[model samples]
Target: MLSIIVAVAENNVIGKDNGLIWKLPRDMKHFKETTTGHYIIMGRKTFESNGRPLPNRTNVIITRDKNYKAEGCVIVHSLEDAIKEAKNDSEAFIIGGGVIYDLSMPLVDRIYLTKIRHTFEGDTLFPELNMDNWNITEKRDFEPDEKNEYPFTILTLDKKK
Candidate 1:
């Protein structure tokens, strides 16, 4: 199975200047827990923004640059190649920058989304999802806490049968 994991602001913002706009600890924790031990595929910019490979996960990077290389990651020139490399894993995660998210959205089986209640000014935004195509399999709402600035909801959506 292939899944997409992302946090988006009310305005659909996901990042600004190649970095995430929010610092929600719970969301971060959820991300780590969900993706651990899975094969994670990301675009070159997303991989660079993360600085290094995530521990305990197979990191696959999609980049147009044929010569690009990261010490702890498998670099591929296309999304198809990335998916092919992760085909043997029980589950593979699409962890993104906006472009990557947009490209992989149609191909993924599930989406793990953290929906923040506040709007943010950002250079990058998540693609608009056609909700009719997805069914919410799980949902949890959280109030703002000291460690998290805004109220948010964690939603697990599966492509509708």
Candidate 2:
């Protein structure tokens, strides 16, 4: 299965200045737990923002430029390459910046979304999802915590086959 994982603010903002706008620990844990041991594919911008490979997962970065290279990451010039690399695995996670997310959405089998309750001003946004094409298979709401500024929910959607 191809799973696309993304965290969005209430207004659908995914990032600011090519980096995440919020630092929610629980959300971080959720991402780590769900994507561990699977391939994590992202765009070059997102990979650069992270500064290093996420542990225990195959890191794949999509870039249009052929010369880009980073330690411990498999760089590809296209989505086709990313998909080809991920085919050996049972599932792979597309963890992204806007460009990669937009390109991969149609090819993914499932979507793992962290929906934050509050909106923030941001420069980047998640792609618009077509609810008619997806079925929500799982959803769990998280209550506000002392450290978390906003409540959030984990939403898993499977594409209608």
CA lDDT of 36 in candidate 2? 93
Q: Which portions of model 1 show Cα errors greater than 4 Å?
A: none
Clash pairs, model 2 backbone: none
TM agreement with the true structure for every prediction: 0.98, 0.97
Q: Tens digit of lDDT per residue, candidate 2, span 1-161? A: 89899999989899988788887899999999998999999999999899999999999999989899899989999988998998988989999989889988889999999999998999988999999999999999998878777899999999998
Best by TM-score: 1
Weakest ten-residue segment in model 2 by summed lDDT: 142-151
RMSD to true structure for each model, in Å: 0.7, 0.8
Give the alpha carbon lDDT tens digit for every residue of 1-161 in model 1: 99999999999999998898788999999999999999999999999999999999999999999899899899999899999999999989999988899999999999999999999999998999999999999999999988988999999999998
Model 1 score (lDDT): 0.94
Identify the runs in model 2 with alpha carbons over 4 angstroms from their true place. Answer: none
